[model samples]
Target: MSNRKIKTFAPKGTRDFLPVQMFTRNKIINLIKKIFEKYGYEPLETPSIERLDVLTGKYGEEGDQLIFKILKRGTGLDKVGVELKEFTVTDYKDIIDLGLKYDLTVPLCRVIAMHKDKITFPFKRYQIQPVWRADKPQKGRYREFYQCDVDVAGSSSMLADFEIIYMVYEILKTLGFKNFLIRINNRKILNAILEHCKIEQNKSFFVLSAIDKLDKIGKKGVINELKKKNINEKVIDNLLEIILLEGTFEQKLNELGHIFKENKIGNEGIEELKEIFYYLSKTDIDSDFYSLDLSLSRGLEYYTGPIYESVVKEPKIGSLTGGGRYDKLIGMFLGEDVPATGTSLGIERIIDVMTELNMIPETKTITKVLITTFDENLKQESINTTWKIRNSGINAELFFEPLRLNKQLSYANKKGIPFVCIIGPDEKKQNKVKVKNMKTGEEKLIENNKIVEFIKSITD
Candidate 1:
């Protein structure tokens, strides 16, 4: 006999969801999907793997390094088991050709481009699926996680951007999040800040990337990072003075508008923000839930106009959702650009926060009742009763073995089955069944025909 121990672990940063966890996850997903559909966004899905070129150069430099690239198949794969450990990046072009998707936005753009002729104008779609990243796993981060994204393409209106923001508020509020804020900024405003600082064009992304880390590393850390990038000391100081400007949403906008009054792109971004805020003011959305911040520079290179990120103050896990306008991303696939805006709700992080705060309702099992076989003679009766319960739209389980009554009852109790039916010899003769309520220790003699109604009356 062999005694080798087999490896049974899931890869790092992945998870195996048990039934109970799945119940909670499905509850959250269903709620989000309802909201997405309510807002006229149709559901869409994409393949887990995409062409290497399709994913690369879309996310910025750091993001490009985190893609889980797949090695090419064929003769190159012949040495996988023997020499794969020795492979290097220099061999990538000949060997690696595909990678797991880093996020849903790129794939959505690819879809719009490939099917542009067949799709309608101002196309709206929602996608809920897992994306893979080669990131280091941590408390609230994972290599494989689900992103619930909703995007509207072919619409250049700021209303599209506002709708995305409103939906973020709706989903979080519906999920019982009260202490969250939606931070808004515009790439054009950021560009104006860079130009005002006299930062060279080539170093603009580097500066924005550092500013994006302000939330994590704080003001001092961002300054140190810029210094490491050889950004001039004066440039760093000027950049900090602008992004660090703080006040109410309107106050900050007014200040930025004054500073960038002479800048064309900056004023344009300021106007777009004003338009979105105008729409927000007329809605039921509370002013406390959303705000404008000049420092919220989303790291993705694709974000062209307004950018947004939502954060909860309670758990402090970081942003729960984020997205922005990427009018030029679709143009990479199509010959011309298509305006788009969207947000992705980080399901894993949301679930983590909800679970930590004891927000998910306790749901131990889905089965409502268990029918036990009283004896070998009554096995068929138990099966028949279970089928009747199921046909009546109730979830019921039938005991597989004709074991002792105590043992069968223990099984039902352990599984959290609320009700158990015992069709004993006496009850069988009387055309009745002994129904026991597991929680209350109460028993009732239910007629064979009335068992379904009785269970429904109590369970419902």
Candidate 2:
């Protein structure tokens, strides 16, 4: 035998979803889509691969390096002075200009740019698709994962922002996710504060990334890390003072007005937030789910305005959702500013939290009845009964093994088949069948003609 090890496992950072797991995942996706449509969003799809130039430089510096690139095909690259073996192409843009899309937002923007003439303004779209990233995987984070996104473009109204916020609250509630809080912050407000505080441009990103970890690393840890970055105590204290600044939504805006009185952009951010809250006040929603968290930094380079993140109340799972408003993302392609806001629900992360909390409902076994043939002589009769039961909407499968009656029942029990029907020489002779509730350990004899209804009754 060869000395090579067996290749029996999936690549790291990816997964294979079995039938039961796929069922659960599809159910969740369907629920989300139903809610999204009810909110007047249209379904849209984009190609899984796009020009690397389209995705690169979109998600910040850290995100750019994590992109998975595709290599140039054919042997002709050697003729073009390309060393295929010694130096392989890694940057997708340099090799073929196409790569697997890292997120839906960039492709969505590209679509809007190319199809502007075919679509209407104030376009509302929802995309549910998988994105690829070449990052080291961890619990609740994967290399290949799905993001459920809903976005509205071509409008800058705070009403649209409020509606999206309300949409999130309703969708989570419909999905039975009660232990989440919606954290909101304005990037413009953040930029204003940073500019006013005289924080260097390069230092601002490091500080924002560090502050974003407050939930995971805690305040003290964040402060210590900030100190390690050579940030003086006075700058850290001043930044904290602005973040800790709190009052009623309106009162906070007013206080913010005083702090940013000399800065026009800062005041604009506060005004936009006030309009959002004003519209939010008109809706009857659980106020506890929404909060103005100053520390929230969505980390996307494109987010130029407001930002949002969703975290579970349990404090174990990190934020399961995040998005923000970006003013110039479309401008990169369309040559004009198009204000848009959107959010992406990290499907796997939410599933992890639900599973850990025992919030996902126990899967009800779909196979309701198993038909067993005790004797080969009666196998045809049992097959006929199984078909009749299945025709009547009762899922019944005929046992494959020619084993004893008790063994057949034991196999059905192990498969979680809730009901079992047995037909042997004795029962077939009497034109009857024995139906057993595998769960309850109860049995009853029924006429062969009534087997379908009997199975249906037990299932219902």
Candidate 3:
């Protein structure tokens, strides 16, 4: 065999999470699940690969570009070569019919479509899973990441929207995010402004998509992008005026009242939002967390109703979560309408913000003790000890390998295991074990029956 070859690495925009990273990730997932369960949302999961047609056009132009397409299996290579020589693949939509799901929302819409006859109305479900994005990785962005999504479908109730908003606030706050805000907006309100300004419907998506990045790229950048689409300065000024004028939500409603005088659709949207806040006001969760942000447009063609984006108040990261109401999305799939509202919390970003704020608890709670397997002779004793310690409600494990004592101890120390139990021929004969507290660099001999208490004391 050849001497060696350079080892390959994971594709760009993806990463391997070592022990510490996985620890924090699991912690965040658990916390989100707890909050989701507390609000009576059931859990559901779907396949990772979805038909390409089901996902396309739901996210608008830019979003469609980010879907990771999967090619046909087997001798498909022959067809690919022939097709490539003839022309670009853009014209043949059916050739590329499979893709890794870009987001959970689209597949979820498909699920609702197929199972509408079986699923109960007003279904509340939460899904935590990895999604693929064919975008360049940045400081806090990744190609593969987890989105903790909670959604309510089949109900047009504004109360569901309020409940989701409060759920986001409580979940983050409970996880020690003290400085944050849930920004709210309505797409109908945006549509009214565009129509009142005499802007065409086709041009409206381009304008809203540009404004959606205002938080990241600022107003000047948005104006530049809008101008590229041939939008005039007067309309731009009016758009900025509507976005900038801010006060209490009620005050903003009064302001919107003047703009919606001729646009009944806009008035209906404003009234729906008013009822959402009214219902929220009666809840125990603090209302201050939700803010009326006219500029907070979630850039998705599917969102025809209320939208939300959560941002950490202090300077740390970008929006930790964002979602909106997609009223007619199911209609596209089921040939019938279903009102749905959902939010996707960026799991990695939330953990990053928590770490920056020093909110992540460094617990010595993970395996506290490791009982080394000295010999096959004493394996049963070691296993019994591990179970006893575990049965006592302390995290403990038996070393699977029969490596050297020093190597085993080193491995235990590296894993932050504080106590290492040594059971050899001598200790087994004496009915006693040696407990080494790695953190304190101390060791003691304790009776076999008393080992659990000894480990507990060390950990405690």
lDDT of each: 0.91, 0.84, 0.85
Ranking by TM-score: 1, 3, 2
Tens digit of per-residue lDDT, candidate 1, span 29-68: 9999999999999999999999999999999889999999
Candidate 2 stretches greater than 4 Å from native: 1-5, 75-96, 216-234, 313-315, 374-377
Residue 198 of model 2: what lDDT? 76
Among these predictions, the greatest TM-score belongs to: 1
**Candidate 2 displacement at residue 380 in angstroms:** 3.3
Looking at model 3, which ten-residue stretch has the lowest summed lDDT?
75-84
Backbone steric clashes in candidate 2, count: 0
Off by over 4 Å in 1: 1-3, 78-91
* Model 3 CA deviation exceeding 4 Å by range: 78-91, 217-221, 284-288, 313-316, 362-365, 374-380, 390-394, 400-404, 442-444, 453-460
User: What is the Cα-based lDDT of residue 20 in candidate 3?
Assistant: 75
Could you arrange the candidates by lDDT from highest to lowest?
1, 3, 2
Q: Residue-wise lDDT of candidate 2 within 1-460, one digit each (tens)?
A: 9999987998878999886777678888999899989989999999888877898999988998888876655535636766666755555445566689899898889989999999898989999999999999888878999998999999998777777888888878878887788888888888888877778998998888888887778878888988989988888988877876777667767877788888988988888888887777777876678878878887789998878888886747677888888879999999988889898888988788877888777664568889998777888888899899989977778997779878998888877889888887778889999988887889899998887887777789
Question: Cα deviation of 320 in candidate 2 (Å)?
Answer: 0.8
